[model samples]
Target: MAVEFASPPGNAHEIALTGFQNLARFTQRSHREGEYGMQALPETDVTLSAPRPVHHLGLLQIVAHESIRNSAATGWQYLVLTEDGAVASSELSIGTDERPPVLEQVNMGPFVQSTASALEGLDDIPDVQSGRYELHTLKIPALGAFLLWLRQLDGNADLFIVLSPAPNFLQAGRIYREDELLDALEGPARKRLEFDDSPRGRTEK
Candidate 1:
């Protein structure tokens, strides 16, 4: 299923605060194979939530496995949403055993660290230029959500990653240009998959 980005009318801080509040409601999976891969191994159950089955299992599996390396047990998985409240794409964060630790290690590179730093709540989100992409980080300091937007110089699809604070490190990322980085600041909330205790079976919403 695509992630839902619609939020109750409000400013960027309000929207982000609301999204983080919702994140607390998600059920936690103890098994590696449970819902959204929180169990022995992350697996997808067609009968659960999510509007459709995951089409990119290989990539997601890699991400799920990799996530463990960071000791990242708390996660908020969801679809990347646009400023206007639409699913931009599906994103995954696997648990991995490798580590001193890394952020977004599933897709490692300058983008990962740069984006994470921007959202770490140190100062304000900084604008970073990496190769052809100009990344602008938007953070609602009062709230837990931070959005990282990477616009390309060639007018191609831009990259966006929305993040919330850790413990429950939920993220939604995708490549699209329908929504401007600033517009997303106005509001942001996306739908996520829900899982049961059984690792092999999960329900998506």
Candidate 2:
């Protein structure tokens, strides 16, 4: 099955590219040999090339073990492909009337590799070819969870695959429906949110 991605806002790519270029320049200057006071700085030459937007990162707030809230779109995640076939990732904040999109962070973590792997194996997943799916990322900060959200475009049969460094009880590379994933995370969310039966702490299921 081919994976599709949602379109990001207009000019987002240009904005992200500009910010990335600025970072690259700074890294080059700072990492150059014999630069005064730069000896102590770690060598961080930003060699990422061909920045491409991959997925729309959506934020999810876990209000309780049985409840979750979908927050506004966080931004777009771009994958940087280098000549060596290595993959890196960067985040750009969504632009608003008050400010333009800005590079949020750059990372060389499991996220990049995991996402690539997921996309590659997407077709092998059972029942994936039945419907069109748009790739997105779901981040649950409180639970330290990040997942590749394959949202079915014309149906309710969405799927989620937990990324590496998977949180407790959630296995990486496993496909889960919304309810199944939520059920598995119930214990963790309850512990994290300190949910109780008391009205003050009770979470609406």
The estimated TM-scores of all candidates read 0.22, 0.74
Mind giving the per-residue lDDT tens digits that candidate 1 earns over 95-165? 34532211121222233343444333322223223235443333333234445544444555555555433
Please give the CA lDDT of all the candidate structures. 0.30, 0.63
Against the true structure, whose TM-score is highest?
Answer: 2
Q: Which residues of candidate 1, in runs, are more than 4 Å off? A: 1-131, 164-205
Off by over 4 Å in 2: 34-71, 95-99, 195-205
lDDT string, candidate 2, 1-205, tens digits: 5667667667666665566555555655766654553222122433433233333322223323232224346677766555554346667876557466677876667787887777778887766777788777777666778888887878777788899989768999899887887777766766754643456434322
Q: What's the lDDT of the predicted structure labeled candidate 2? A: 0.63
